[model samples]
Each structure stands twice: as C-alpha cells, then as structure tokens.
Target: MQDSESLQIARAMRRIPRWWLIPVVVLVVLAGLGAAYWAGTSTTAGTESTPPLAAVVPVSATVERRAVVKQVVLSGKVVAGAESVLQASHAEGVDRLVVTAVAKEAGSHVAPGDLLAVVSGRPLLILPAGVPLYRDITQGEAGPDVESLQTVLTSWGYACPVTGSFDLPTQQALGFWYKAAGFKAPTASDPISQGEAGSAAPKPSSSDIMFRWREFVQVPGDTGKVASIAGSGAILADDGVVARIRVADDAIVARADVVQAEQFAVGMRVTVRAGSTALDTTVAKVSSFLEGEHSENTIPGKDITVALPPGAQGFAAGQSVTVTAGSAATESLAVPLIAIRQEGGRPYLLVQANDQKNDQANGQPRRLEVKITAQADGWAAIADVDGLLVGDEVTLQ
Candidate 1:
C-alpha cells in the first residue's frame, strides 16, 4: 500500500504541467526588466532636475583725473568798435555847398591831416579830434575854441600854451603852422598904432588863420578807414551825412543777445574765428542794456567789445564770426559719465570694495553718493565722496 501511494504522488507532480511553469518564468523575467528600467529612468530624471550654479560676469572701470570745462558758444559779427558818421556843415553866412572832387574813395585808409575830398572848390582835410570849428580861430579870440586850436597846433609838432586866451605865442605858432601847410603867413598890426586916432586897424580874414570853419572833419585817434562816401556831385546840406569812418585804434565789437550777454564778463577769454584763422582775445566791455528795437516776441542784444591783440588783423566789418567763451577749468577726481547713475533725484556711483574679508558687508559693489561739479567730453568732475578714491575700480553697470 505505501509503494502505491509514492508512485501516485510522483505522477501528480508530473501532471502539474510544463506550460504553466513556462508562464511563471516569463512573468518573473518581465517584472525584473520593469524594475531595472524604472531604476535607470529615475537616476536620469534626478540628475536633469538638479539646479545649476549662477555665473559671475566681471565689469569694472578705473577712476582717473580729468579736465572739465564749461563753455558757451555764440554767433556774432565782427564790427568796428568806434565809428563816426560825417555830416555836412558850413560857417556863418555860407548858404550852399557842393562836392567838387572825391580825393579818397570808399575803403581808403587815412591819417590825421590827410585830405579826404574837395568841397566848394576847397580842400576838405581830416584833423585831430577837437571842438567844432564854427569860426576861424584868430589871435584875438578868447574861448575854449582857442584852447582847442592851440592843442591841435601843439600836437602837430608846434609848441604853444593851451591857454584859453590866444596870446602872442599862439599867433607865432599859427604863423608857423600856416607856413608848414603851404599857406601865406599872417602879418600882425601894431597895437599902439591901432589905438591912436586916425589909424584904421586891419582885420584878419579866413585865409589868414591856420584853420577854417567847416573845411575839415576831425577824426578821433591815430588812423581810420573810410566806410562810405557820398557821390562827388552830391550837394552838401547842413546836416547830411557825407561819409562814414571807422577808427583803427578801437577794438572789434560783437553784439550778444541778452541771454548770451549775461554769461559774459569783463576780462573773460574768448576764441574768435574768422574763416580759417582763429584769434584769442578778452572781453573788454559789456553794455548794460539792449541796443536795438525788437518785436514783442524778440529780445534785443547788448554790445560786447573784444580787445584784439597786436597783429590780429584780417577781419572786416559785417563779417560773420564765431565766439567761444569758457569758464574757469576745474581739475579734480573724475569718472566716465556713464558710470554715474541717478536715483530719486540724487546721483550715485558704484565702487568695488578692496577688503575681501568682509564679504558679507562688502561682497557686492558699495554705493556712494557723489556730486557732479562740471562735465566735458563724456567725463564729469566729481566732488569728494567717501570710499571713492583715484585709481579705484568702479562698476559701470
């Protein structure tokens, strides 16, 4: 009976089926493959999801010493500093006058005592500045006109006292002047003979004096250039302008608008440009008020005189020019204009700290407050600020 039971157990184990065993083995292989694939995918996903470290970009600039200039440029014209308009006048009892000949044309250079033109068939001469000659200065004259004549005579190499009264010495000087001017000398009559009864005194005529009334236009200073002249056939009216002259000794003047004039000051240096040449000059004078009339919307300008240095010639009146006026230079610690930043209407700069041990306090760039005093050529002159020094490395952005 035990042998029969053992044989039956063996038969049952064999009958469990080889097909079922094969299915179990395949399921086991699939589970292992799934576990291995899941493990590999999880490792890759973890590596890809990790965060990266930030990158460090270095940007810096060096502080340097630079010159800062503040300047204003203006447009103007080159004009004569002193100009005079000559008018026609005549002595008492003279009715009409006519221009006969024009000896000096327009743009003619003239000096004291030079002949300008011929009026009423007589030479019209240029004389030194003096009181207007209303009548011929004679030996018996006693007035300021006499003193002026004496001064002119002395200036012309003839020595004579400038006393208001024309004395004997004046008469002698006048005689000498007449001889030098190619005129006949005057003869004096005896005073004692004239005082006696039955003696007729001879009166001096216009031709007897060294100067005549209204025959010359007195020019101020040493030399002048004629700007304009009336035609030779023009009639001489009492108050008609005959010619215009520009004095040579005066400086070159430029008129600036009120806004521009406010920036000008006496003795300020200026650069004047004419064509291809440039001249350095100084401000000689500034007018207190506007000089011309303007429309309601326009503002007139004031006159500004510039002192031309010696040999600064080659400029004409009415020629267009450019003027550059600059303020005093300021030299101090400076930086690039781009380095400065504004926040809340205040200027600030970023400076790199030198101490690396205090990384928590100064790891990043330090902020510094700065004031800009002047600016020029993409650079700014800065006031002294804490933690800012020359040669310090600064962050621009």
Candidate 2:
C-alpha cells in the first residue's frame, strides 16, 4: 500500500506543468544571448572610434611696403608766443589820467609809431625800443641812448647823425619830430632844473632845446596785435596796464602737457590741428615744474611749448587744438600687428603657402624671423628678414 501511494505522488508531480517549464528555460537562454551581443557591439564601437587631431587654424594678411611713424598725441590750446604790457608810465608822469580816445581796438594790427591811444588829451605813440624815459632829453645829454634816438629819428626821414652825442643835428631832428607830432618846438634856453637832472643842484642849460620824450611808448620789437584795451572812459593810475599786445600772426604757439618729458626735446617736429586746419610746427620749450595751485589727487606732468609756422593764420587765442609729436619715419616692409608673434624673446611671423596639399600633409607652418624697427597706426615696420616679399600672404596664427 505504501509503494502504490509513492508512485501516484511522482506521477502527479510530473504532470503538473512541463510546458510552462519549457517556456521559462527558453526565456533565460534568450536573455543571455541578448546581453552577450550588446557587450560585443559596445566593445567594437569603443575600439574603432578615436578623437580627431587638432585642425590647422587659418589666418592671412598681405605684406606691403609702407611708412611707419611713431607719434605721441596730446590735447593742447593756442597761446601767444610773446607778449608785452602797455602801462601808464608810457605816457609820462601822468597818473590818474582819463582815456580820451581809442585809436586801435583789440584784434587790430599795429606797427611802429602807430597811435595806440590818447591819454590826458595827448597822443601816446608807439615807437621802437630805446633808453627808458626818466626825464626830458635835452641838447647837452650825450650817450648810447642818444645814439639810439638819433637812429630812430633818421629812420623817420629826419637828417641826423648817429654819433652817440646830442649835437646840433639831433636837436634839429627833435624839432622836426615835435612839429610833425603837433607839439611845441624845443627852445635852447629851457631851464635844466635839479629834478629833471636827477640831482640836488640845479644847472642852467646852454642850448635852447626841450623835447617831450616821455610822451612816446616804445614797443619791444616787430609787429603785434592788440589783445586787450581799456575803454575810453577808464582811468589809468601809475604803473597800471592800459593795454596788452601779443605777437599772434607770425609768432603763434601751442601749450601742451605730457607724462614723459624725456621723450620730447627742443627742435622736434610736431603737427598741430585746430578744427579742420592743420599746421606743422616745432617744439620751442619744455618745463617740468608744477606751477600754481592743484589738488593733492592730481597727477604731476610736464609742459611743452610748440611754435606755429608763419603759414598758420586766422587762429585765435584760447582756441582748442590737438598736437602730434612724431619720430622719424622708417620706410620698410610692414604688416598688421596681429600677424606678429613673440616666442622666447624673439619675434616671428607665420606665412601661408599657396599649396594646400603640402600644408595638410606636413602640418608644419612656415615662419620668418623679423626685427621690428618702428610701430605706428596698428602697423609695424620689419627688417632683417629673408624669403619674404611685398604682397605675400602671411598667417596670423
């Protein structure tokens, strides 16, 4: 009875689901094959594919012959080259004098012996430079000052000899000058007082001569323009300035500031520009002193002066301008700044060849050694180079 029961149990177990076990076994086999195929494909793709090498960068520029000028640009203003002040002393001991008439206005041109103004109802004439007028010049006076007076008198069509002595001819010339200027003729018997002689004792004059020498205002030299003038109703005091004259036409100059004073020197050429006008000039002076008041935060700099050429005209004082101080030009083969490369303290330039196959196969760029002589305006002048010519294409990188 026990054997029969065990046999029945084994048959029941065998008949329970043989087809379901077959499908489970096939599913496990298919999963193992799929995983192996995926692993093989991934390994093949990783082994076959590799990153490409870096491609050649391309840049090109034309080589040419040009002028390279190194220049320093600065902002500046127009000013007078030379100036002189006309004071009340030009009209003698006439302090607190009223301006009766204005012969020339500001911006008017003037020459020697021109009427600048009328002070105290008398003409103030502009004359050439001579001895300062301390007192009235008489016939007995004789010196180099008298010689200067005779020279000027002769220039004005008067017949006088320049003997450095106030002789008869000088006195006659003084008379002619007085008559021409509408003044009283000098008399030989005029008293020579102690005050006029700058002495304590008074003396009598032997000659009849008395010239109003203090009535004239002598200019320094050359022609000038009236920069400023007092109105007709203004009162002039002792040593007070009546007008200001400047040498503007032929002696115009420019003032500018620079960070480096050693880079500039006197007699260096410069170009000055005002609006649309431009003029060539030269540096006349340079000062390194800091003048006047300034804030503590301000940076110190040097001042430079440039004299304008005579051809530059119609420029007004205080006009805004720009100046460019340049070095000597260097004529040579030049290229753009980007085309140059520096390596190991040496400069070089890459040149692009016309043949592409060789460049692609070799992967080596051609370079030329160069010495930069001058650089300006985004270009560099190069020298001491071989195998390079004008119009050749150069690579930047």
How does each model score on TM-score? 0.54, 0.56
59-80 per-residue lDDT for model 2 (tens digits): 7899999889877777667774
Query: For all candidates, what are the clash counts?
Result: 0, 6
lDDT per model vs. reference: 0.70, 0.71
Tens digit of lDDT per residue, candidate 1, span 1-397? 9999999999999888677788899999999999999999999998896688988776788998777886667766676557777765664444566776676877788777676775554555676676656765555678888888778878877878888777777777765654454333333332111221122445444334444555667777747788788788889767756778877534666667878888789998988888897888898889878757565333568777777663467667677787778845757889988898899999988887776323346377777889999887888899877667898877876
lDDT for 3 in candidate 1 is 100
Candidate number of the best TM-score: 2
**Candidate 1 runs further than 4 Å off:** 1-61, 64-66, 78-109, 115-121, 185-211, 220-222, 228-243, 248-263, 273-279, 291-302, 307-321, 327-333, 336-391, 394-397
Minimal lDDT window, size 10, model 1: 190-199
